[model samples]
Target: MVKSKSIYSCVECGGRVLKWQGQCPHCHLWNTLVEAVAEKNSTRFNYTNEISRVQNIEKIKIGEEPRYSTGIAELDRVLGGGLVDGGVILLGGDPGIGKSTLLLQALCYSSCDRAVLYVSGEESASQIALRAKRLSLATKKVHLLTEIQLDRIQEVLGKEKPNVAVIDSIQTIYSESLQSAPGSVAQVRECAAQLTRIAKASGICIILVGHVTKEGTLAGPRVLEHMVDTVLYFEGDAQSSFRLIRAIKNRFGAVNELGVFAMTEKGLREVSNPSALFLSHHEEKVPGSCVMVTQEGTRPLLVEVQALVDKSQALNPRRLSVGLENNRLAMLLAVLHRHVGIACFDQDVFVNAVGGVRITEPGADLAVLLAIVSSLKNKPLPIKIITFGEIGLAGEVRPVQRGQERLKEAAKLGFVQAIIPKANKPKHSVFGIEIILVDRLEDAVTAIF
Candidate 1:
């Protein structure tokens, strides 16, 4: 007869411990230890062994055929043109972030050349079908399956011979052989590993939807993220109707690609011109406002930057920033004081990127700095002015990449002037904006003032 055993696992790292402790030595997180039913000395059925019989590195060959597109241009762009065969992609986001909706839409509108299977452990076929109907996807080829047992899922995969498969979420699916409950680290890791092997052996593209922690990272163990070929994160304000899907890791394509979608009554609509949605058309020019062109992956977008500086009565002035790095804001403020003689120490500074879009590129540094300075000076920047260039510690304005695309986007959006790096030589004379080249931070301030 087999004997049952008990074990404690660190919730953060999934490391096994004989007993519970106040803090986990493996993950350093406090009070995250949970008692789990440990499996006795046992070995479950190995799927990789079956795969090894057929799939060796020497047996694989490269093909020239392109990846399969899902018929959504924005999604295709974020996925580097299309979904790669045998790729395992993990999609994560906060609850109600539309992770499942996006994949459901993709599966419904996907090119009908391949057999597609939609597996859901969280929702019923009728629920998913209703969503598909609202999304205007009334296709017959897309098969739906609702199951949680990993063995059953594998059995279906073997019989269905699907070219593409999607698991609604990873946390809900459990391997029956695992003694631990669903969403346990062991179950998540084991399931992800099996799915990855199946995907590679069958030449099927597998998309796994995953839940997110409160900190907004993919839930499950960190190993779950490492097991996949790509990690895509869906981000946006829950209260708002806009969402951004970004690829943070891709083995076959470039990272940092972004896809913009607006959730509506019908379904998610791709934002073809995102810049228009980011900028506000105000007849009267306002102080503490500026425009900047930022690049995400290969695309350039123009957005508005706003700042407010107010005299503080507290002993320590507060510095608050939204959609921009707070530490970077502090560093820029210090540089402004040291080089440009702007004393913001007695004032409370607040910086925000309009439209809730986060900007991480250093090219936006000059625009953010200028916006703060303009607000402190109570001066309004030119209405049609747009600027973007990296700011160095030495008060130098460094050149940004893809300057031509930035300028072109600004021009298309009715911007009349641009303060860019002096090193960028325009390919030809363009007329919409007067391009003012500046090589230093003070020069940018002067140009704007």
Candidate 2:
């Protein structure tokens, strides 16, 4: 009989310690160590009897992996052309963020031709059925399994041999071998490792839904993300109907890919043209409003940048930003004071990207600065004008990647003029837009004002 012993494991790093401590010694994080049970003599294989073979790198043959479409074009785009055989995808999001709804819709649509299974450890069969019926999805061929035991789930997967399977939230699944509670660090890590091994060995595409921490990162040990083939995050506001899925890691496709969807009474509906969703239309051009183009993976997106400047009565003025980095905003304000002769030291400044969509790329730097200046001066930028470029500390306008693609997208959306870095100016002018090339911050201000 194997003996069980108590061990302390760090939730952030998955490092084990013999005793408990306030801070995890491995990761140096406070209060992340949790108690778990481990069984002695758990190893089933003898390393002394195992033999390994090595082959030449040139002798290995490569072939294209088969992909199964989820029947949603936007999701297909984010997954890098659909789900690959034996690939494991990890999807994380906030509660009620439509993670399960999107997957359910996809499985229903995909059930037309492929064998798909939805294993629910979180929801009951009737709960899932009610959601499907509410969404008016065709679920005749879709298979449902309500189980949480790791061994039983693996047994069902082997017996059913479905091409695709979804474990609706890995946090709820537990293994009898490990005497840890479900959703614990040890349980999550062990269950994910076993499921990934099964997917690879059986050529099954598995999707694991993960819970996010209060900080919006995936919960559980960090190794859980490393074990998966792809990592996707669902982002949006609860008040808003729009949701965005972003790919942070992918082995078969590109990372940072984005898929846009809208939540309706029925279910999640893919937004064919996501650019329109991020742009706000007004009766007239307003001060502190500017349009900019940003590149998300392979697609170019147009988003509006808005700013407001007000007199501050407080000793220290407040600097706030939404949908854009706050630290970058402060740096940009300093640049404006040092280079552009505009100061916001005594004013309260706020900046926001028009939609809930977060902008990470520095391509929106130029547009953000321009919007701030416009707001301070109480002047409106010209209508149908777009701008995008990176700004350096020395006030130089740096070129961004895919400049031509951004310009073309802006033009296609009826933008009449573009203020871009001199290096980003196209070799041949776009048919409908006039390009204003600026080499420095002063040049941009002069051209715009």
Candidate 3:
């Protein structure tokens, strides 16, 4: 018989210790270590006499993997042409961020006619049924189970080997073999490893809904992220109906891909034209409003970067921004002051990406700096102008990647002119829009005003 021993493990880093301590010695996080039982070393599978030894990579058979489409084009794009058979996908989001609703809708409209099982530990069967009815998805061939026992779930999976399984949350599932409770670091890691093994062995695609910490990350061991095939995050403001699904990691596809969606009473609707959604309409040209093209994966998105520079009332002027980084804003401000000779020391500056769309790429640097200058100078930029390029600390305009694609996208949206880095100037213009090349930030600002 195998014996069991007790040990404390850190939830933040998975570091284990012999005795209890207030703070983790490795991760230094306070109160994150939880006591868990460690079963004695025992091998579950023996393959000494079997033919399943290490094989040559060249000799291994390669077959085309099947893809299960969720019936959402945007999601399919993010997942790199739908879900692969036996893939483990980890979806994380804040409470009420529409994770469950999206998965339910996916199950309802799956293009693949395979059987699907959705296991939820947080909601009862009746509650799930009500939600399905509300979404008008009562007739979809999706099964529901509200069990949290990991052992029982595995047993059911063995009995009913569905092609796809959706675990509403991995944190709530616990193994009876473990003395620790659900959501503990030890249990969460072990459960995920076991489920992933099952997925590979049975060719069962599993999507695990994961709860996030207060810092907006998965609420279990950090290793949970490394164990999954893909990691997706749902991001959007609560006040706004617009939600963005972004892929941070993918074993089958490109990373940093984005899927735009709109939250509705019926369910989440995919936004076909995300550029139109992020750009606000105006009757006349206004100061501090500038259009910039950013690349989210292979897609080119045009969004308005708005800025407001006002006389300061306090000693230390207020610097506020939405959908933009504060440190980057400060750095841009410093560049404008030191290189461009634009004095904003006493002025309060506020910058935002229109429509609550976050812009992380530095390609928006030129547009943002121009927006601040336009607002400070009280001059509006030409309505037909589109600007994009990275800005260096030395006030030089830096060329961004996919310059031609960005220009074509802007021109497709009816822009007549573009201000880009000198390095990005086309040998021969592909679009009808006139290209304005600038090597330094001062040159672009001069051309604009």
Name the TM-score of candidate 3.
0.93
Q: Identify the leading candidate in terms of lDDT.
A: 2
Please provide, for model 2 over 1-449, each residue's C-alpha lDDT reduced to its tens digit, 9 standing for 90 to 100: 96668899888788889999999999899998888886454852223223668989899898887787999999999999999989999999999999999999999999998899999999999999999999999999999999999989988998999989999999999988877799988889989998998888889999999999999999999999999999999998999999999999999999999999999999999998899998998998899999999999999999999999999999999999999999999999999899988999999999999888899999999999999999999999999999999999999999999999998999999999999999997987898999999999989988888
User: Clashes in each model (backbone N, CA, C under 3 Å)?
Assistant: 0, 0, 0
Our tally of clashes for model 1 stands at 0
| lDDT agreement with native, every candidate | 0.87, 0.92, 0.89
Model 3: worst 10 consecutive residues (lDDT sum): 41-50
Using all chains and alpha carbons, the TM-scores for the candidates as numbered come to 0.92, 0.96, 0.93
* Number of the top TM-score candidate: 2
* Residue 51 in candidate 3, Cα distance off native in Å: 6.8
Candidate 1 segments whose C-alpha is farther than 4 A from its true place: 1-4, 8-14, 21-35, 45-65, 427-431
What tens digits encode model 1's per-residue C-alpha lDDT throughout 1-449?
77657787775677888888888888888977777778765776465544334577877996764698887899889888898888999999989888888887888777477789999999988898888887788568999899999999999998998888999889999987888889887788889988898998888899999999898888778878788999999999978899999999988777999889999877788999998767878889888999999998888888899999999999999999999999999999988988888889999999999899999988889999999988998999988999998888989888889898888888887889989889875788566889899988888898778
Model 3, 377: alpha-carbon shift in Å?
0.7
What order do candidates take by TM-score, descending? Answer: 2, 3, 1
What local lDDT score does residue 56 receive in model 1, on the 0 to 100 scale?
A: 75
